[model samples]
Target: MVAPTIQPSLPRVSPWALSSFWFGSAFHWLLLLLILMPADIERLVGSAHKGTYLGLLSGLGAVVALVLPPLVGSYSDRVGKRITFIRWGVAANVAGLLVMGFGLRAGFNVYLLGFLLVQFGNNFATAPYSALIPEYVAPAQRGRYSGVMGLLQLSGQLLGGVVGALVGTAVVPRELAFVLVAVVLGLSALVTILRVPEPPRQELPADTAPRLGWLQLFAQNAFFWVFVTRALFSLGQYSVQPFLQYYLHDVIGRFRLFGLNLGNAVTASSVMLLAIIVGGVASTLLAGQLSDRLGRKPVIFFAGSVMAAAAILLLFGPPFGGVLLLALVFGLGFGAFTSVDWALGSDAMPSRRSFGRDMGIWHVAFVAPQLAQTPQGRLLDWGNALQPNLGYTLVFGIAAAFFLLGVVLVQRVKNLK
Candidate 1:
């Protein structure tokens, strides 16, 4: 007998609690990318090979990111458990991070293993966790909730940068940063698990086929364009990001702007990142609420343009202070785009039955771009060999083109809102 419906189509979930895990996720990512990895790679390989080695590390680690999420999410979908998978991932992550700390002293291969494990652990947790919003939140509320997601996510990143800055200044031991990351991950995840109840297990209909892995998802045109646009934007970002510390060191060094002397390249990089995060935090929350009322495309349009303009401006040799302002502008636009990110994805998901599998597939847009890091590094290296600091100009130009292209293409997405 069919049961009569007794409640709303979706369950009530606290946006704050729902977004707690994002903070943990963004925290570790920034911690590693901004400080830990760069410092270690530079020490191990020297500055000349730093870009290439770092790219290799990212490319290798992303193999796990590319292959693991769909498999893990598909299994979680079958088993019908989210928190258990997430907890197990946390255990793995802590182990990996600790190993990385020890590996800092041990050797490069050992350090690589730690990074790979970190990827494994992070992807395993996130694949299952990614499905929660679509399953729990009402469509009308998604923008605001997504805003909350971006807000906490950036806030986490800000804290990570702060940790990096502290480490850069030698206020905190590098090893201690790993501990801080592990503790934060555990606490935030505990809050999410405690506050957010998992929905009851669902059974696949008799006729519905199980959603296969990544390739099958490409056949859905609506999602394919969404994936493409997102990948382009991310590619633009990774193009600049993976080499930002190097850019700071090589291009803009020892500038005194506004009575502030930032002679240290690492400290200068942290300041720029902080400026970006500050702008990002403000816009992330605002844009999410705006996307709810104004629609996703319009907000996305504004965001992409802003980012493109910033990238183009960066190609010009701006003063150190001017660059900081440009960074803030870039952050504002990027934050707005991210605010609407999940709402758009939720809107375009191909099948309700395969939220886990489909979201896992969708997430490849972010991961796939990391694969380009090797080529990007090679480009920088190649360009620099030909001339001095021409690599930064070439890279910045590439980033601008990516931003413009990504912005223009968003209009092509069906009016899913």
Candidate 2:
């Protein structure tokens, strides 16, 4: 009983290898969610009904994102070919992005199908892809990896914001922007496919084979807590996200700088998002490293609390400048949370052999909030009808509550730092 053998570690990840794929992922998604989708829906259905239609689209598409990942991940676990799944997913996603772009004038049904396809493809790739993290990095180094992930993720958001402001104002490209989205997204995945090799499956030395049902395999207490915590966080974020453009227009009024028209909602929203991203970028890497030294729980708790406070402040209908400052505050908290988000689930994974499947179950948390989009949208409509911007107040109030609860519940997650 003298000394334990040290396992050889995976090579350190290059920053490019770690970040490029995620940056592309964030870029396309933000382009769609924040700018394109809203503008398109408004154009098709008009501003009066934009919120409801957007909610309908998001909620419907969310079904695919919610269901596909867990099942696909389990299949990937069995097949041991995560890269193949990723390739297929990318192909489908790119095709869907093209359909959405080119089919802009083709009515809502075509747009809906395109979005559904994108959702399916994105969730399909991400589930199996997420397992790569725990496989490639040592536990101690994960915070650094997450930090890098957050930084690149925010950077992509900044680019998406720029593109959206430029092209998304009219629901696109005209088609070049949409094509650009498909291109950039596909190219990013290609980078990872070419440069980052998938790690070989890690199997337990002394395996005990036992028959367990699908839910039983992944339904541990820690998993349950983590799922609830994550779902709550996503709930908070999405509550405001789908409505930000509208908020900038309705509540703050369209912005202008130096006696120049900033082109209504898109430009103002982009400016707000830029501020947010700046704050998030500044804090992301630092937070990730901090979590490594200080424990994930403390960092996440503090960040969530900050976000909750910011959301609460949004209820007042602050002026444009004040809103940008609040966005900055919110972004700082957002960066810290996202920095460690993957590692959060990775740490609490119940089955090493079934990492893909378990992680996919956790991925459901991200999509669960999408289910609320429609209901919340309807609520916004109703509240606004009752008394102007009352809907926003309710939506933000609930979001703040969700944020606080999500952060607090993490304290209950056993066996996680």
Top candidate on lDDT is 2
Candidate 1 lDDT over 1-417, as tens digits, reads 322111224568899999998889889888888778888899888888888899999999888888888788777776667778888898898888988877787889999999999889988888888888877887898999999999999899889877777774567788888888888888888888888876676443445434544577676666888888888888888888878888877877655679988777666777788888888997998899999898888888888889888878876767889889999999999899889998888777765567777777778788878887888888888888889888888887888788889878887787564
Model 1 alpha-carbon drift over 4 Å, by segment:
1-10, 203-216
Tell me the number of clashing residue pairs for each predicted model: 0, 0
Clash count (model 1, backbone only): 0
Tens-digit lDDT track of model 2 for 255-339: 8655666778887888888888998998999999988898889888978898999988977887677888999999999999999
**Residue 65, model 2: Cα distance from true site in angstroms:** 0.5
Q: lDDT (CA) for every model shown?
A: 0.82, 0.83
All candidates' TM-scores? Answer: 0.94, 0.93
